[model samples]
Target chain A: MRRFVRQAAEILRGDPAADRVVPPTGITARLTLFTAAAMAFLAVFALALSLAAGRLADRWSEELARGATLRVSAPAGEMEQQLAAALRVLETTPGVTEVQPLTDDEQRALLEPWFGPDLPLESLPVPRLITFQETGGGYDPDGLRLRLQAEVPGAVLDDHRRWRRPLLAAASGLRVMGWSALALIFGALGAMVSLAANASLAANAQVISVLRLVGATDDYIAAAFVRRFTLRAVAGAALGTAVGLAAVALMPDTGDTGGVLTGLGFRGLHWLWPLLVPLLAGAVAFLATRIATTSVLGDLP
Target chain B: MDLVITFDNVAYSYGGGELLTGVSLDIAPGSFHFLTGPSGAGKTTFLRLCYAALQPTAGEVRLFDRPAQELGRDGIAAIRQRIGVVHQDCRFLDHLSVADNVALPLTVAGRDGPAARRDLDDLLGWVGLSKRADARPPELSGGERQRAALARAVIVSPDAILADEPTGNVDWEMSQRLLQLLVEFNRMGRAVIVATHDLGLVRVAKKQVPARVLRIANRQVTAAGADL
Candidate 1:
């Protein structure tokens, strides 16, 4: 423990403000800062995309899994009869709680987007709609479909499982893809930071050579660069994160009812997740700089 | 007494070009020696071996009874803290003041020992560089740079001091002052090895202090003639 504290204190001993004065300004600092900023920005998007995909999957799976839809298509004379039979079948079903048939106006409202508004539904061969609510133990969808086919030949049972399954599966795949994108972003950030650090080390070769000649160990020399780059990356990431979070906050809040894109921002407690990005980026920079500095110094006399 | 340094049949070649070959020597504790040689004779390379900075391509270099090449980074660091080195270039962190530059060894060592103003002032005064303590390396003359390097070397009170061409840029008076400081450190029981090409300085040094002059030629170190 004492050794750990001693090492930490040793690492923190140097004044970066003083030491950084000798490193010529402009290109190197710009490269490091720009890379940090770009990585952080991409990280923000990845986090949002992953969280959004997760929410999408949960919402679709929950809403559709517990509900089923009923469609009744019969002769104009038999439409009411078939809907009535389907509703009766659903009522006798073990888990069925509430079953309601759509009024003529409601059926016309459903098809208004595709057909004209002045459709005479009484004469036209339009299908009737009914929605069923299931209790704790839902009805067996195959049994219900068979009962409807025999009792009401024009009736169709849609448990919503088939559509919901594929949709939820796609959402889950999207979540994985989103997370994979985040992982790739992190890896890319590490690689870029490592390269920038290596370049910085190469640029400051004379500084290292002089330090070594004066009996500065590889650790002491590495600490200077590590401290410098780590702080820069942290500062840059903080800026990037603030901008990212602000952009997320400015997006339209599509609460539970709103469409997908409007709800792109973080939900409850998810705001805390993006805050870790800067810390992780800083840690990456710290490790990258240390590795680069030590490797270069190891090659020196 | 502990043997501070030993080189046995050490052959060092840089990428297959031999600089020093079949060299065997030992540096005893508290002994002062002048390593004199012509240009391209690997004087700096030899000094690097003393502190375990450059490993011998063959044979062994032992510092304080431990083989130099076997010393890991931490081990080499420990050995380095026991020795202070001055290069012919008299390098310094050009951004730092002379006082800060002088305090580098202590700072790097994590020593809580105070670098009192008086101590720095006195060391600077001894080297005739007290007035330039606030100056950066780039601001100082070549001789002043050499003196600052010397102050940094002795700041840690190391077991040994290794200087390569320490006085190459200074005049006779300044060189004599630098020699006196090394002689004083030797009196205080610090082993000293100075590599230089100046036979005149070596001759002048022989009068006030007993220093063995080792000459490097043909990839080996030979003692100077007795006539000196």
Candidate 2:
């Protein structure tokens, strides 16, 4: 640990002579910084996407799993009797906490987005929906369906298994894709850093020769390059992360839209996640530069 | 005196052509020798072998009693610290100041401090480069660059100094001054090997110090008499 601290200090307080040995390549420096910043920006969005997808999937699965809907359809005169019978069966069902039939106004509000605000409920033979909340393990749909068929023949129990399965699956898949995007961003950052380092080493071949001729060890020479690139990556990533966070913050609030597009953001402690982007970028640059410089120096002399 | 470097029946080849063959020599502490040869001769190759820059294609070369091939990367670097080399091009980090270039060896060795600064100032003063300490390598004259190279070479006070064509790009006055500085190092008990095509500088060196002149020809080394 002490040795590590000393080495860190050495990298922080670099040897001015060693750094001066390698002439700066302006294009390569700018390219590395720009690439790091761009990658960090993308990485922030990817992380937010993954976290949001995870939240969405969990909420959909849990909420849909715990509650169910019962729809009763019959002749217009018999519909009232069938819905009352269906509600009685649901209220007596095990694990069913609250059973309430949807009021005409509530049903109209649900249809307003598709049929405009003035939905003609009296003209259509609309099915009555009994929304039931559950507790503990929730009511068994098969058992509830058997009881409803025996009592209210027109009632159908929808456990939401069909739509819920596909919706949860899609959310989970989206989460995986978001995480994969993050991985791809890191991979691209590594490749860019490696190319930049290799270019710098090639351009400064004479400087390397001079350093080797003067008895400078390979590690000493490599440290100069690694320190420069790592610091640049860190700085660039920091700036990008700040901008990305601001952009995410300025996005339409999820509460206003209540849609998936607006939900691409962090919640609570999740905001701390983007802070790791710059650190990870710095580490990638450090490893890439170290490997490239050491490999090239080893090939010399 | 201890033997600083030894080449035993060593040979080197480049692109399937042998440049040095059956060459055997030993450099002793405080010894002064001059290597003179025609163009295309292997004087630089021999100096490179002495510093472990190039391994022998056949036989063996040892530095400070350790076989060259047996030394690891760090070992070679450590050995190089004890053997200073000057190139014909007088290569310097052009971006660095003359003082920084001269103090390169110390900085590489992690010995840079107030003491190193004082020593560097004294050495630059000795080479008459103290006034141009802040000047960059490209800004210095050929003579100034050569002096800076020499100062850099001897700053570490290595056991041996190998200079390849040190006076190749300088005037006669500058060559004489460089030779005088080399002779001074010889007097201070450091083995010095100078590779040059300048017989006049070789003769002057012999007059000032008991120096051996070896000439490389026909891919082999042989002693040359004073008449040559």
Candidate 3:
């Protein structure tokens, strides 16, 4: 840690002679800056996507796990009797809170997305869906199912385990993929910085030779390149991060009903997370340049 | 006198071909020596060995009582700080001004300051480059560049100075002036070794100072006769 602090201080202490050693190549400088900015921009989006997916997964798991649905299918004459019997059984079950039967308009609204607004719910033989919210420890689905089967005869209890598990798994998978994309962006950024450093070093072979001839140590020479590249990365990444945050902020808000698209942004304190992009870029550039410079200098004399 | 450099049966080769073989020499403080040889007699290679720039292929080369191979990277750099070298090409950071080029040794060693600045001014005046302090290296003549290289070499007040073909590209008058600078440094108790093929410069150097003249030919080094 002490050595790292000293190295950081040395980097901050500018070396004008060392800077003069390598003449600036305009192409490499521009290339490095542009690459860093591009990578940081992509990285910001990936971070947002991962966070949003995580929130979606958590919300889906909690809401779906805390409730159960009962569907009763009977002839028009017997439909009322079956729903009344199911509601009566739920009222006496442990941990069952409020059981409410869906009105015809509510059922039609749920099906409107698929069947359009002209659906005739009164003529269709669709089963009635009764949703019951749970409190404390939710009532056991197996016991509830046994009681409903014996009493209501035509009623089916669904704790949503079969479909909810898969949905949650899919959301979790999406979150993992978003994070993996971020990792790949970082890897590409490091590679680009390394290539730029190597090119600069190769172009300044004579400068390095002159420095080494004048008793400049390898660390001194390497420090000059490392400092220059690190600063460039930091500057480029800062600009990219700012632009990314602005883009995210401009996205349309969907209020409480927002789906995946509207939810793709930082929430509250999560806005501070993109601030780390510049720091990460600087660290990557520092390490990449150091490694390349050291390797090249070792081969010099 | 304390010896500053030693070579014990040192041999160097490139691409499996020998350039220098069975060479032994010593450089001591306050000594003045001239290395004379043909164009391809490995004169530059020998100087490089003296400064730890190149390791000997067979025997050992020592600088200030330490084996060249044993010194770490930083140690080698430290050793080099005490030994100044003027190359045949007179390499300089072309972007830097004459003053900066001449004061490069001090800057590299982290000794740059107001006092060092004054010393740089004096050194430039001694090299007759006082008026050209702001001029870049590319704007200087061959003689001027050679003088700047010499100025840089002595800026650190090194214990020994090595010049490889210092007069090769300059006129006779400029060559004599450069020789006088080396002789002045030698009189200050610093070891000076100059490698040149010009026998005339060697004779002139001998007249200006007590000097030893050595010649290399056929991969061997020997003391030259005074007949030259």
> Judged by DockQ, which candidate is best?
2
Lowest lDDT sum, 10 consecutive residues, model 3 chain A, at A1-10
Q: Model 1 clash pairs?
A: none
Q: In candidate 3, list every pair of residues with a backbone clash.
A: none
Quality of model 3 by C-alpha lDDT: 0.88
TM-score of chain B of each: 0.95, 0.98, 0.98
**Span of ten consecutive residues with least summed lDDT in model 1 chain A:** A16-25
Please identify model 1 stretches exceeding 4 Å from their true place.
A1-25, A76-81, A114-125, A254-258, B112-118
Candidate 1 yields a Cα-based lDDT of: 0.81
**1 against 3, candidate with superior DockQ:** 3
Scoring only the A-chain of each prediction against the true A-chain gives TM-scores of 0.82, 0.86, 0.85
Worst 10 residues of 2 chain B by lDDT: B219-228
- lDDT of each residue in A99-128, candidate 3, tens digit only: 889999999999999999988988898899
On the 0 to 100 scale, the lDDT of residue B203 in model 1 is 86
Error of 1 at B203 (Å): 2.1
- lDDT per model vs. reference: 0.81, 0.89, 0.88
Return the lDDT, model 3, position B213. 90
